[model samples]
Target: MANVENRGNGSYRLTVILGYDEKGTPIRERKTVKAKNMKEAKKLLTLFEAEILTGEYFKAEDKMTLNNFFPQWLEKHAKDTLSPDTLQNYISILQKRILPKYGHFKLEDIKTIHVVNFINDLKKNGQRLDGKDGKLSASSVLNCYKAFNNVLSCAYRWKLIKENPAIGAKPPNGKAKKSEVYSKEELSQLMQLLDDKPLFWKTLILLAISTGAREGEIAGLEWKHVDFEKGTIRIEQAITEIKGKGVQIKGTKTGKERTVSVPEKLLEMLKKMELTSRQDKWKVRDLWEWPDHFFIFGNEFGKPIRPDSIGQWWRRFTKKNDFKHIRFHDLRHTSATLLINEGVHAKVISERLGHADISTTMNIYGHVLEEADKTAASHFELFFKKMN
Candidate 1:
C-alpha cells in the first residue's frame, strides 16, 4: 500500500509499506517529490509504488554522479571495445564538453530537458578550443552529441538510469563536405609537371592519382606488395601516427585488404625506384635500420617515410609550382572523378577506392553521376539528330 502526504507548497512525501521484517516490524520505502496539487501527488505516488514493486526503484545511496562513473565506464567498456583513435576522441569530447557541464549530475537526475538544453547550448555558443573566434563547427557539435549519447546509453545499459535522456535529444545537422578534384585537363597538366620532379615524388603522386589510395596506405606500401607482372598493388596496411606514440603500422582504415591495378608506366617507375633503393641500400649497408621491412617509400636508412611528411611535401610542391591548391587527399578524389567520367561502373570504383559498399561511392559522387547522366542524354539526342 502507498500513501502521499502534502508537506506545504508543492512538496509531497510518498511512503509505501511492505509486509513485515524478521522482527515483525514494517518494512517501509519513502521518497519526496514535488507536484502542483493533490491529484499530481497521488499520480506520482502510484508510479513510485509501481516502481518499487517491480524492483526498478533506485535508492538514493546507490546513485552515482557522471564524474564518478565515467572512469569506470572507460575501463569496463570503452577501452576494450573502441579503437585507440576513437577512444581518444571520445575522451576529448567527454572532458572538454560533457564533463564540465553534467559530470556532477547523478545519472537518474539527468532529465530529457537537460540534454536538450545542452545540445541547444552547443549550437548557439560552443566556441572552438583552438582560441579561434568562431563557434564550434557543426561536425564538432555532432561529435559531442554522439559521445554524450554513447555515455548515457552505457549508463542505461548498466541500469544506472531509468531512461537515457540523450536518446530524445536531436543532434545538429552537419552535411558532409563536397570533395575537391582536378579536372581531366588539370590532371594532365599535373602529370606533365611531375615528369621533371624527383623520381620519388613523381612515383608517389602518380600512385596516389592512379590507385585512389590514402596517403598512409601509400606510405605503408612494401616492395613485396607490388606484382610487376600483373601490374597490381596489394593494399593491406597503413602507417599512422598516434599522439605521444609516434608512428605505427596498422591495418587499413576499413580493416579490409584490397588489390588495385596500376598503369604499366607507373610499374616501370616503381622498378626504377626499386633499383635506386637497392643501390642506396648497398651504400648504407651497415647503416640500414629496417633491412627486413623493405618498404617501397623507405628513407635512406630503410624506414618508411612518415605519413605526415607526404602531405607536408605536397603543400610545398604545390606552392613552389604555383599550382591551384588542393589537399593531397584531393588527388584520390581526382582519381575517382576521372574514373566516373570515363564511365567506370560504380561498384568497380567503390572496390578500387576500398569503400565498404557501392552506396558509399554513389553518395560521395552522386553529383558527378548526375552530370554524367546529363552528358549521356545529350550524346543520345545528338545521335538521333545526326541519323535523321
Candidate 2:
C-alpha cells in the first residue's frame, strides 16, 4: 500500500510500504515528490498504482543506470526500425560520449539538475567527446541531447523512472549555415573541366549539376526512368552505405517517388551515351555478366554505383582541378540557385528537385532569391536609364 502527503517543501512525499527487503527486514520506500501540488501528486500516485498492477515497480536498483538503459533501449527497440546508418550514429555517441560520464550512476538518482550538469560538463570538456581535436558540431550536440531524452522517455514509459530529467533541458541553438553556390565564372571553369573528362563522368556530373538529383537517385536510375519522348526522369530509389552492413539500395529518401523534367539537350546527351554503350559491348560486359538488373550509373562490373563512390570521384575531380571548398551535394545547391537566378518560381524548383515540401525548396534557395530580387531591381534601373 502507498499514500502521498504534503511534505511542506511546497512538494509532496510518497510513502510505499511493500514487503521485506533483501535481508528479510520490513521495507518501506519513501520517495519525495517533485510535483508542486496535490493534483499532480494524485496523478503520480495513480501512475505508481499502474506500475504495481503491471508488476514493474522496480525498487531502485543500483545497477540500472542511464548508461545501462540507453544502450539496451537502442539495441532492443530502435535498431531494427532505424536505418542502419542512424543506428551506427547512436552507437558512436553512446560509446564515445555517454557511457564515459554516466555509466556508473543509477537511473532514479539522476535528476533534472544532473542533466544540466552533464551538459555543462560537455562544454567544459572542450565540447569534444573524444577529448581530441575540435569542438562538436551544433547538430551533433543536439543529437546527443535528443538521444538522452529518448532513453529517458522510454524509462518513464516502462515506469523505471518517475519523470524524464531531460524534459525541458536546453538543447544546442543556432542553425547550420548553408554552403555557398558556385558563381558564373566558377561554373564556367567547372564546365570546362568537365569537357576535359571522360564522356560518362562528364555526363554524370553535368546531369547532377543541372537537375540537383541526389547522387544515389542519379546512380540508382535506369534507362527506363529516362523519358526522351517526355523529357523527364523518374526518381524511385537511393543507395546508402550502412555501417557494419556495407551498402543497401532503398526507397527514395522522402519515401514517395516522383518524376523530374530534363532539358532536351540533356536528353540528347543521354541518348548519345546509350548509343555509345551499345557500340562498346565490352564496356558493359562485367555488369552484364552478373544477375543484377538495370542500373543507370552502374560500375564496370554492372552493379549499382554506390553514392560514396560518386563522392570520391567528385573529391578527386575537385582536388585535381583545384576546385576545392565544394561538396557533391553543393551541385544540388548549384542547380537550385541557377534556376532561381533565371527567375523560375520556388514551386517549380521544388517540383524539379522532388522535394516533398515547398518550404524545403525555399529554405535551400532563399539566398538565391534575395540575389534574384537584386538582379531584377538592377534590370529595372537599367531600363529607366535607357528611357531617360
Candidate 3:
C-alpha cells in the first residue's frame, strides 16, 4: 500500500513500504512527485506502486542520471546513426546547456514541467554559441528544443523512462524568414564580374545555381560522376566537417544518391577543365600519388576544397566586386525560384533539386509560385476580350 501526501508546494510525496529488513524493521521509501493536479499525482503513485510490486522498479544503482545516460546514448544511439553535424549539436547541447542544468537528475525525475521550464529559460536567455552578439532567434531556440526532446523521446521508446515528458511540453514556434535570393539582373551582373575568375570558382557557382545542389555536393564531385555524353552529374557523396573527425566525405544530406542534369554549355566548360587539369597534374605527380578519382572542384594540389573556403571566397569576392550579397545557399533558392517563374512543373523542379518531396520545393519557393499563379490567371483575359 502507498500513501500520497500534499507537499504544500504543488507537489505530492508518495510513501511506500518495500519490505521488512533482517531486524524486522519495515523498509520505507518516499519520492516527491511533481504534477499538475491531484489526479496526475494519483496516477503516478499508482504506476510507481505497480512497478515496485512487479519487481520492475529501477534500483538506485540501476537508475541513470541525465549526465551519465547522455554519453551512453551518444555511444549506443547517436554515434553511427546521426550525421556528424547533427551528432555534434546533440553532444554540444548535452554538455553545455542540458547536462549543466539536469545532469544530476535521474531520467524519471524529469517531468513535463521541467522540460517546459527549460525551454522558457532558453527563450529568456537566447544566447548563441557562434559569437554573434544578437539575441538567439526563436527558430534557433526551437532547434535546441528539438535536440533535447529527441533524447527524451529515445529514452521513452527504449523504456528507460515511463513516459516522454517532452511530448507534453510546448513546442517553440518561431517566425520564418523568407530565403533571400539574387534577382536575375543581380545574377547577370555577378556573372560579368566572374569573367577573369578561376574556372573552379565560375563552375562551382554556376553549378550551384543551375543544379540547386548544396556546396558539399558540389565540392564532392569527381570527374567520374560527371557524364559528358549524358549531360548529368551523379551526386553520390559530399565532404563535410565533423566535430572530432575534421573533414571527411559522406553521403548526401538525404542519404540517397540523386542525378542532376547539366546544361550543354556547363558540360563543355567541364570538358575544357581536363586540358588545364593535365597541365597541373604534372606539377604534383612526383610530390604525391593523388587519388585516381580527382574532384571536379579540387584545389591546386588535387585535393577537394573545403566548403568553408568557397564561402569565404564568395564573401570576399562579393565585397571586393561590390556585388549584391547573398549566401551561397541562396543560389539554390535562386535556381528553384527561376524555375518556378519559367512555369516549370513542380515535380520536375523537385527532381532537379533532389528534394525528397514536391511539397518541400513548393513550400520554399511558394512566393514565386504565387506570382506564377497570377500570371496563369491573367491568361484568360484574351478569351474574355473577344466577348467584350
lDDT of 3 by residue, 1-388 (tens): 6888888778999878888999998897778889888888999999889887865566677788888888778888888888877888778877888888988999999999998998888776436777766667888778778878888988877777878899999898865678888888988898899878988788888889899999888888888898888899998898897766666788888877888888987887888886687677777886533466578887666777788887899999999998888888888989998888889999999888878788987787777899998998888887788889
Error of 2 at 301 (Å): 2.0
Q: Looking at model 2, report the run of 10 residues with the lowest lDDT sum.
A: 284-293
10 residues in a row with least lDDT, candidate 3 = 286-295
- lDDT score of residue 44 within candidate 1: 96
- Per lDDT, the best of the predicted structures is 1
Models 1 onward score TM values of 0.83, 0.76, 0.84
Query: Could you arrange the candidates by TM-score from highest to lowest?
Result: 3, 1, 2
lDDT of 2 at 256: 62
**What lDDT tens digits, residue by residue, belong to model 2 across residues 70-120?**
767886767766655566677777677777777677887778786777666
Give the TM-score (vs. native) of candidate 1.
0.83
Model 1: how far is 284 from its true place, Å? Answer: 5.8
Tens-place lDDT per residue, model 1, 1-388, is 7899999989999999977899999888999999999999999999999998877888898899999999998999998877666778999989988899899999888988988888788776536788767777778888888888888999898888888998888777776577688998888889888889999999999999999999989999999999999999999999887778766788787888999999999999999999999898899998998767788999988988888999999999889989877999989999999998889988999999999889988988999988988988999999999998
lDDT of 1 at 356: 83
